[model samples]
Target: MWGRRPARGTIVKICGLRTIDALEASIEAGADLAGFVFFEKSPRHLTLDAARALVARAAGRIGMVALTVDADDERLAAIIAAIQPDFLQFHGHEAPERVREAKARFKLPVIKAIGVGGREDLVAAKAYAEADMILYDAKPSPGAARPGGMGRAFDWGLLNEAPREKPWLLSGGLSPETVAEAVRITGAPGVDVSSGVESAPGQKDPSRIAAFLHAARGAAGGEAR
Candidate 1:
């Protein structure tokens, strides 16, 4: 399993991509995963055609992840039909049972996002032990429509108290500059990034993507630089 041991290299992810150029940048930069948002409310959301095109362009050179927020079976089925992503990331209020159901239905590995605001939120990961991976992201502020990519960071120290049963990715407000510290503080096996590689909302800056990946790799004691 991916989470059984400490990941030697930080699993860099360049997410919220909507263009072929951006996807290519992520692959060329050696990102471990490329993400496409499916929520209509997100500025980064992609149309079915666009998502399929991006997935096709990737051509299995890198792992592809589909990001969805509280989607029902019908919507998930539609997205799965279109992209057939290598991994499914749930960034919503989905219970562990829902995560299990999605995993069984899609037969794809599930990466559940656990929003961390305080020590209490760490408990949520317990319900998702069966998930293929866990993503520890900063909790979105109250009333925020989205569950993640709010560009806010939480206390990395809180993660020290989390039991290391399952592999987890540290996310939220991670950038080229802060990723090393985030890794050092949390000792996370993997890491995920979305807005940190973007020049603006919904716009991926290829240079920033490369820089973030390089930094994350260096932080993980790799030669990505």
Candidate 2:
């Protein structure tokens, strides 16, 4: 199922950051990217001004990714105008055509998220190969209040048997303790965390962010050929 090895070090992303301290900690902990949630329903969501400030602090020190769910063109345009994030992450039910359209319209690299609960979910990822990257998150159950950051984990073994040609990230219920295992199991080039690094919903814990990065780096170094 694996196509190519990720770089020697696992690309770490600390997501759902809402504070300057958390943002700085991510960079200090060696995170490759930091994610800002823009979905209002999510407790981690950030306003335009807040997001812009956070992005400014990052200042190209690390990749800044804006997470949205099925946002319309106008909203996306406004966000692009404000923060000009390095990447746009779509976590909604956007189709491949929409992914193509959004990429073309914004002229930004896109990371399409796929919710994986079982084998069927892997099939859904096939349609998004055209995307610059794919994020594999746990599927939300029916009537769930939020789409992701639920701190739930799907079967990592499911990905071990799937076919993948594009770079991808493994997310969902990942914490400092389990990130290494997730990387070892899926061989993901990147791993994303939100709730795992939080002391409470929407509240980031800097210590957890540091530990997660350290553990992920160690695991990536110890992987066998």
Candidate 3:
């Protein structure tokens, strides 16, 4: 199956995009994917109409990811119909069977997000192997309302020389200042960020976004001239 690949560096996914300006900033800054939050409880959440308008502006310039958390098929259907996203990110407690079902149902790539606080959590992969992609993120605090975008960092060392055969993304607590170090330590093929580039919850800062991409390029050894 053909999918959008990073042009020349580690994949960078800027999530929680709610505005066209931020989306354009992500594209101009050389991001590989733009993520839209569909979970209403998220401060970054956007209505389908809001997401659609912003998506139109993307216009194939970059990949788009629809992020959801334990959403039912009905909600998923609505999101798919409206956003028409290129990828689906399940950031909640979803079994591999659920991931496979979503893929078969939507015919879109599914990125299963796993929260890891320790090396033991990597075992979760056995159940998510069917997903087209995997995203490793810092585990949320107990009873935290949101699954991601919480600015928590995990031990990058856990992923060092780890046995992961599937395409994967490293996320959580990544910012322009620390992204390079995170990449160097973890050797991630891709990185996903949300609150790290924001001035406030759901608010993306353009300069931060640009600096993140530029910095990440350096980390991935694809430094832009």
Global Cα RMSD, each model: 1.5, 3.0, 1.9
Scanning candidate 2 in windows of ten residues, the lowest lDDT window is 1-10
- In terms of lDDT, the best-performing candidate is 3
Candidates in order, TM-scores: namely: 0.95, 0.94, 0.95
Tens-digit lDDT track of model 3 for 78-99: 9999978899999999888999
Candidate 3 least-lDDT 10 residues: 1-10
Q: Rank the candidates by TM-score, best first.
A: 1, 3, 2
Per-residue CA lDDT of model 1 for 1-225, tens digit only, reads: 465323447777777889999999888888878888999999999999999888888866988889999999999999989998888899999899999899888898988998899999988888786688888888988899878848788999999987688667889989888998998888777788878888888889889888888888887787453
lDDT of 2 by residue, 53-154 (tens): 888899779898889999999999988888888899999888999999998888998988889888998998888866888889999998887786388999
Q: Clashes per prediction?
A: 0, 0, 0
Candidate 3: lDDT of 133?
Answer: 88
Q: Which ranges of candidate 2 are over 4 A from the true structure?
A: 1-8, 222-225
Question: What is the lDDT, from 0 to 100, of the residue 69 in candidate 3?
Answer: 95
Q: How close is candidate 2 to the true structure, as a TM-score?
A: 0.94
lDDT (Cα, 0-100) at 91 in candidate 2: 90
After superposing candidate 1, which stretches have Cα over 4 Å from the reference? Answer: 4-8
